[model samples]
Target: MDIGAIAAAVMLAVSVRKRLDVFDGPADITTSLMMVGPLLVLGWLVAIALFGGYREDVFGVGTDEYKRVFNASLVTAGMLGIGCYLAKFQLSRGFFLLAFVVGIPLLLMGRLLLRSAIHRARRQGRLQYRVLIAGSPAHVDEVAAVLRREPWLGYHVAGALVPAAHLAEETASGIPIVGTTEHSTALVSTEDADVIFFAGGALSSASQLRTIVWELEKAEVQVVVAPSVTDVSGERIKVRPVGGLPLMHIDPPRATDAARWGKRLFDIVAAAFLIVAFTPLMAYAALRVRLHDGGPVFFNQVRTGRDGEHFGCLKFRTMVVDAEARLAELHAQIGFEAGLFKMKEDPRITPPGRWLRRFSLDELPQLFNVLRGDMSLVGPRPPLPREVAGYESDMMRRLRVRPGMTGLWQVSGRSDLSWSEAVRLDLYYVDNWSMLQDLSILGRTFGAVFGSRGAY
Candidate 1:
């Protein structure tokens, strides 16, 4: 994929340079490109390999792979430019810039698409690694649940080797208990495992753990340790070696960055652009809502925002005028939730409202809230005032940033999510959000909206 992207970039650069020959002095670009492209691609691959971008452990998850690719491409471009300058080769300054400027993104995109393919394959039970978990039964269950939650990680939990004292027939998360942790090596062989995860209570002492590792080394099985810590992003956690022991250093949450000028500027600009782009759609939604039983075109409800402030969250009317008045009737059907209240078949939703909600056209009015400083393009889901009132101490974390028009809760199953899971995701976003993560979520939003998997 990297080779293809680099080749395409070279060809594009050559064609672009030819078109700009009026000022760039590159009448015949193809001949030069043909001579230089392969060499550049070879060097680029070598650089990426040297940078550990192709490491197996970095695959299947995280942004580390993408970062390494970006770093490697930049370094390759630097080396090429320096080599050309030192050898007095006219590498066509415009061509040099265009190739890398185009190439790096293409390389990143290729990796992204490749990861999507790999995830799909893994989800279908292909390209999987047989896993042997070593931990206490409780800890084993925790590890298994995470793996189950994201099958695309490609770990097939064969069974668990728990502490002898805590042996059980199966983990609560449904992973069968195979043996005690003392026999991890034997079980790895018997189970034909490719990876062994050491969770809490995996070993009695450091020496015992060392012995197990040494025994497993001969089998060529990968070893991973899952600390009790969970929900921390890779960016916030750093490993520091002290006295031959590795200690994890977790940086403080960057939720305050949500209030920074850069993110605010990005929200303003992106929200404005989206509003303009979707004006026709928004207008149509408004007209349909207004024509439906003579109800108002927009629905505004008081929702809790950053710092527990109440703001009027705007949405195209997705229910009848007396929707709130009828909420008491369906409270029994939905179990009267505290955090997020939703129903698959809410009787109050109007006919047009159903269509608007499915594609998220109903929330189009919230883009104006984004422009009005009441919401953001992406952040935690806006909680109702009643929901905020019942929030536990931990749940209040979502109020640290402005409520979002669309958020992790929106993209990750939306109304289909349980209240606890939705709160967990929102808190995770509040703790770990970055501009890059926001962009990634925005990209995924299109798919989620179009697919309408969880929307009512």
Candidate 2:
């Protein structure tokens, strides 16, 4: 893909150069560009390969893959400029600019496509690695839960190797206990695991951990150490090498940055554009809801916002006028879990309400709230007063940022998400808030809504 991208870029650059008339003609060059293009692309490919673009660990996750490609491109451009200057080669100025400008984005797009394919493959249970976890019962369960939560990460916990004293057939969360540390080495090859994880246990100490790592050295499988840290983004953690140890320095969470002007400006611009673009659709949905039973066109309910302030959240009325009155009756039937009120099949929802909620047209009115500065385009969901009353201290972190129309919770599973999982996703967004992440989530919202995977 990289080679193809570069070749396409060269063609594009040549045409752009001709259009701009940067030089007398293609013959102004000391040599034929078509012939030189291959050599240039080969150099770029070699630079990327030498810069670790093909490393196995970078394939499945993180921005490291993009970073390596970007760095390699910059270096290749620099070396090409120096070489051309020394060789007295008159590379068309317009072509040089167009090549890098167009080529880099094309290369990145290729990587994005490649990653999407890998994720799709992993979710289908193809290209997954069998993983063996070695840890105490508690740590083992925690690791397994994370793996199960994100199957696209391509890790399937085959079994656990717990301490000899805590041996069992399986730990909680259904990860079968394969064996104790006595058979740890044999189990890796026996289970045909592609990776072995060493979490907390008797192996918590450095010396013991080193011994275990050495034991698995000859296993020929990747060995990963699950640190005590969890839920921290890689961007916030930096590795600082001390005398003989690698110390991880973590930057404080960026929850406050969520309120910065950049995000507010982004919300305002995006919300206004969406409102203008969807006005006809919103009008049609509102008309349908009103005609369904001649109820109100919009639902305005007080919800908690940033800093615990109250605001009226707007949505197309997707339920009967007596929906609130019937809430308690439904709660009694299902028995509430985790203080969240939801039902897969609630009698209160009107006929049009189901489709409205399914496509998320009901949430379109919230764009007004976003423009009003009462909410953001992407943040935690706005909680009701009753829900806020039950929030634990940790859960209150979500209030630091404005509530969002669609968030991690919505994209992940919407109404089907467990309360705890919802809180975790919201807090993760608050701590790791970035404009790039917000745009990515917004793009994904369409897929989630259309699929109606967890929407009622």
Candidate 3:
């Protein structure tokens, strides 16, 4: 669809600008060449398809995939440019350039609109892929857990196929255990599975896997492999084939000096701009807090910043003056977890605090923290001293960059997310840190705040 849209737009632009003037002169070979234009458009479309632009995952999501589409389109245009020059065709190069620039954006906009509809359908459970797992009970459970976690991935686990050889008998994960692995392909056919995920832990031979792949292909379900590897970032892995055996290379995690410099520059620029823009909002919020609570407006608390450094983080005070003194008594309160504190219906909050917390007005004062260099405009969510002190090895990596007022946790689901999901999102941000990514997150932060689904 993207290619067709781009091609039609480009061809129309070219046809108009060139003004062929067909009735003025005798027809020539150039006319015939130009008349064969639809064929050229079809060729370009096929080139993009062959380059993987039409794949299911890339079809309707992610800037990364759209970037690929742009690259493929450019490659196709470059090839056409070479052919046009070789044939001495009387094509308007200026029109072609204009079309290339205009059409790509139009194509992307079309895809974006389509993706919004697709996302809505997925949310309503109208469009989803039915998948089945084949492995031992433990591996089956792991697969089911992952599927449940990412509902946006649009996978419904139909069942699990646990073989007696791998397990003692047919055992179940939370999802149904339909049958043994021996009849897995038949089960998939009967259940109408769209995908078959071979979860790790089954001791099936390569020959058996090959046979299963062949059989499942006949059933017309996509096959996917689940390696036992965990906590590995996709960017760190490379596949190299040597002597027909695929070798997986896991590069060591190394934060180099250049990347650090780039990150620091980004933090400085983003923080400075945010502080400048939010200054008036911060002052208004502080005045409201002070007028409402009849106390100091600023809430200052020591939080672990980058590399375990302590910094006084700022927020508009939403609680009473003696809220901290009352903390011990409220510690016994149920529904809120320790370390990661929450007081959804606390008595200490001022009357105005409820509205402030709902829209995240309390976080406006953190712009000062950003300006003071204690925090970034976007990074991991700043951890409380207690949370930082209890860090597992992986959690400490989040502190490599300055903490932020809003981050993965803020944009993901805020206070509503589970501890594990929060950590996973933070880790994902840390591993995939980029200036473009930070800007995208900051843009998304507004939508999350206004939605107010999880702020309180």
- lDDT tens readout by residue for model 1, 1-456: 788898899888888877785555746766666767888999999999999899987865898998888899989999998998898876788889899999999999899899999999999999999998899888888888889878999999999998888887988778899999888889899999999999998988888978988897779999998999887899999999999888999988889987788999998999889889999988888788888788789888999899999999988888988889888878876678565777878888999999998899998889888888889999999988888888889989999999997788888889889888888889899999899999988989999999998999
Cα lDDT of candidate 1 equals 0.88
Best to worst by lDDT, what's the order? Answer: 1, 2, 3
The TM-score that candidate 3 achieves is 0.84
Model 3 alpha-carbon drift over 4 Å, by segment? 1-47, 60-64, 76-98, 165-173, 254-259, 335-337
For each candidate in turn, the TM-score is 0.96, 0.92, 0.84
Strongest candidate by TM-score = 1
- lDDT by residue (1-456, candidate 3, tens digit) is 765686667666666545655333432334544554565567667776777878876765567567776777788788878877898865555556656677777777777777778776777787899998888888988877877776667788888888766544444545677888778778888999999888875536777878888886666789887877665555567889998777889866532321476766776677678678878877777778878858998889888888889999887788899999988778866644555776678889887677789899888777778767788777778888889878899888888777877887898789899887888887777776666667778888998999997877
Candidate 3 differs from the real structure by a C-alpha RMSD in angstroms, to one decimal, of 4.9
What is the per-residue lDDT of model 2 for residues 1-456, given as tens digits with 9 covering 90 to 100?
898999899888877677675456453443558656777899999999999998988875988999999999999999988988998887776777788999999998999999989999999999989999999989988888888899889998899999989998889878899898657778888999989888888374677767766887887788887867878888889989898688999899989998999999998898999999999999889889988899999999999999999999999998899888887777778876556777888788888889898898899999999999999999999999889998889999999999999999989999888888999999999998877788888988998999998888
Candidate 2, 172: how far from true, in Å? 2.4
lDDT of each: 0.88, 0.87, 0.75
The local lDDT score (0 to 100) that residue 185 gets in candidate 2 is 73
State in Å the error of residue 333, model 3.
2.0
Lowest lDDT 10-residue stretch of candidate 2: 22-31
